[model samples]
Target: MTRISRRHFVVAASAAVACAAARPARAADTVRIGYIGDFNGASLAAVATDQGLWAAQGLQPDLKVFTNGPIQIQAFGSGSLDFGYVGPGALWLPASGRAKVIAINDLGQADRVIAQAGIRTMTELKGKKVGVPEGTSGDMLLRLALRKQGMSVNDVELIRMDPSTVVAAFASGQIDAAGIWYPLVSVIKERAPDMVELAKNADFFPEIAFPTAFVSRNDVADDRSLKVIAVLKKANAFRAANLDASIAVTSKFIGVAADKLATEAANSKFLTTAELEASAADGTAAGWLSTLNAMFKDFGRLPDPLDPKAYFRADLYQAG
Candidate 1:
């Protein structure tokens, strides 16, 4: 109906080991992989579960589902999540904290400025009330789009809300335009058939790549994490052969239909394990992360940015 709203421990000691031997393994032994239930990256888990890849990898993932990045960011801060497939802003975590990026998920299309029927373009949005889900992908893109247009948030009445609430506000005539993501993006289209998407995420091109990616506190080097990534990569390899069935499973997960997801899947691209590893080794991934980190800081999303090099592990050299 409406939209809304992770940890691990290990100890090794001679005496502590004897204590552990006295009891069976507890819940802490299980893997907790956090994921946003949003369609943007839901396929990772859907394919993993549907194809039994995670099981094959010997991981029974908790599969924590969140509404958006802002919510997941808290989990990261608390060290509750081991991995996440999130929007481009994943750089924010690694650059500033203990996270590291693994691979790119997709280039977003629905992160855009949607306005009421009468509004046709960004220029028309001047002096109108527009909403953005703070610290999310849509918010980041909206800021960049405005900057590119030679306009600023000062030119409009900026309202901040979550993606789901943005749709509700839009439906209630509380805001004229909003920076939103799916299924809210799809929800808006369905509920307001005449609505106009004034600017798509792709419009602010060249300046930012807007890559949704897989990020982790424990990267591929960790044996447990590596198993999970291997499973995910297996799912990626099988995606083509199982396209229709994959979409059917993902559709139910994202609460959208197979046709809609099929369209989104067409617009997205994936990288194999070898391809992603090569990108990191060659500096392609690092360069993009560096640029996007600086971009978010410039946009006021990140007040104090950290070095991009710290975002990835030294072994992978992805932050080079």
Candidate 2:
């Protein structure tokens, strides 16, 4: 069968669902999971499916690849998905009572501020055109990075552009810099090798954690959620132990070249089962969510920051 690319799947999710329904009957223990088709924490869903890890857990995986978090959240609300991998941009969905954050999949280290070789520090970005995809974690990172340097968006000529446009404009010299994440960051570096990284998501660290989470519907069964987490844990171990093999399978699943996918995957920092458990135990995960909440509110994207505990279900993760 011909494979569908992630871009195609985004526009034809409904049709894909219809096609899934027409396939031979699946096992009764089917689990409907949703994730963004990117090289972030959510990409593990593709690995799980490719490795039959879900089946090993007795789940007939009904995996839906989404273009973004909001669309995945919509699927969860419509009862089409039982669990979803949400990025930092939409972490507020759960805080708003729309879902429950069951696990912190990974800390986002894939985002970076890339600028012309001459621009070495965040403070130097003053008055320069910086491309940013507003409302994304990259945007938040840019704001925080600037703030850390006692600067703000007002210090820069912020040029709003989608990820793809940022790549093109940055490469063509239309923008002085861009706040973007991988694999687009990878793309930009390849297209403009002269560009230098000014800062990264990791630079903000504990002060501003950009984490991607595995979230579920508030009504999902505990047992099923536990099973999902178990399989994901196994998938994480597999990816860490067998990076090349993981990239080979994920490349086919994501429809990106193996080398490119490997580059993109290397940019992220996936948490181990131990790391995840520790973060939850130490209140680190909750702290991360709270930081994200405050960033959104500061940006005027949220009315008010909700308590992290309102959505972060550390209890569920512990039970797993």
Candidate 3:
């Protein structure tokens, strides 16, 4: 396995964000799509754009890549974006009525609590330095993992760091454990092959779901929003069938090497069109959103309880 340096990932992500910020003026008919770069679920927009799926549907897309969901939400506020693909951390924004969730892209399975070989269980991490990106899905996972062991964030010496920095700090022995997600998890394993996994998102599945979502502003036309979802459905099938090709497209779009992205790509499992609709119809999607809403409030990231149904527009999918 080849190691993807922290500096390389940071520089690439920064450059991509800069380019998106400096993008040229869009045409009147352009559909601005904002997404988090280097993320598997959000990268589907890149796949659709590079493969000309949006154009094939007679839609003109103005793609903007951000480093995270909060920043992308700012674009939505400014009316700069018509749609967005965001992680679970930003689910509150939609549930709170900032935007409407048009689709559930995928459930997250790559987040984990990785520890050194000597630390075999979550109990062993007591008082040990654990690196995590605060207010992220990784942070939520870390707290949940701790709670499962009858512990809390207070029991660990929490070291706040971005995902890329978490990789570097963990690889250098600066941190004893990490609450992080893949592609970066893969990077850390490449650098420190002896690292051990203490817990993962899948460990609490069915009870908890960390899903990425596609959202549209309340003012966007229903037809246009449905078209975006249609393009994503096509992109999902294309990605599932042509993994290498999809990786190549995303690699070029994000400035990451295809080989480095391969592991991350393999770790992801996107929901198909039928699966997405089923999750919505069966109340699985609502349950996931409700979980996020409650988690955010518990973490003090949200001020009040918001109904997940307020932002979830499952009717649009049924109409399409």
Better of 2 and 3 by TM-score: 3
Cα RMSD of all models vs. native, in order, equals 11.9, 12.3, 14.9
Off by over 4 Å in 2: 1-26, 77-80
Model 1 per-residue lDDT tens digits across residues 1-320: 22321011232355577887987754333567777765557887888888777767667888888767656656766878777776875457666665676656556665777899988878888899999877777777677778878988889999978767898898877999998765676777877888887777667665567777767764334666567667766776666567778788888876778777776666555555556667667776677777888887787657776665566542432331
| TM-score of candidate 2 versus the correct structure, residues matched by position | 0.80
Give the clashing residue pairs of candidate 1, or none: 6-80, 7-80
How many clashes would you count in candidate 2?
0
Model 1 residue 105 CA deviation in Å: 1.7
Tell me the lDDT of candidate 1: 0.70
State the lDDT of candidate 3 residue by residue for 1-320, as single tens digits: 23568778888999999999999856445798887666575568877877788877678888887755666677888988888877777787886778899888788877789998789999999999999987666788898899899898899999987777898999999999988888778789989999999998889886888898888888999888888878887887777677788888888888877776776665556777778888878888889898888877876678785687778988886555
Q: List the residue pairs that clash in candidate 2.
A: none
**Candidate 2: 10-residue stretch with minimal lDDT:** 1-10
lDDT of each: 0.70, 0.80, 0.81
**How many residue pairs clash per model?**
2, 0, 0
| lDDT of each residue in 157-214, candidate 2, tens digit only | 9998777789899999999988888877777888889899888877877677788888
Stretches off by above 4 angstroms in model 1 are 1-29, 218-221, 313-320
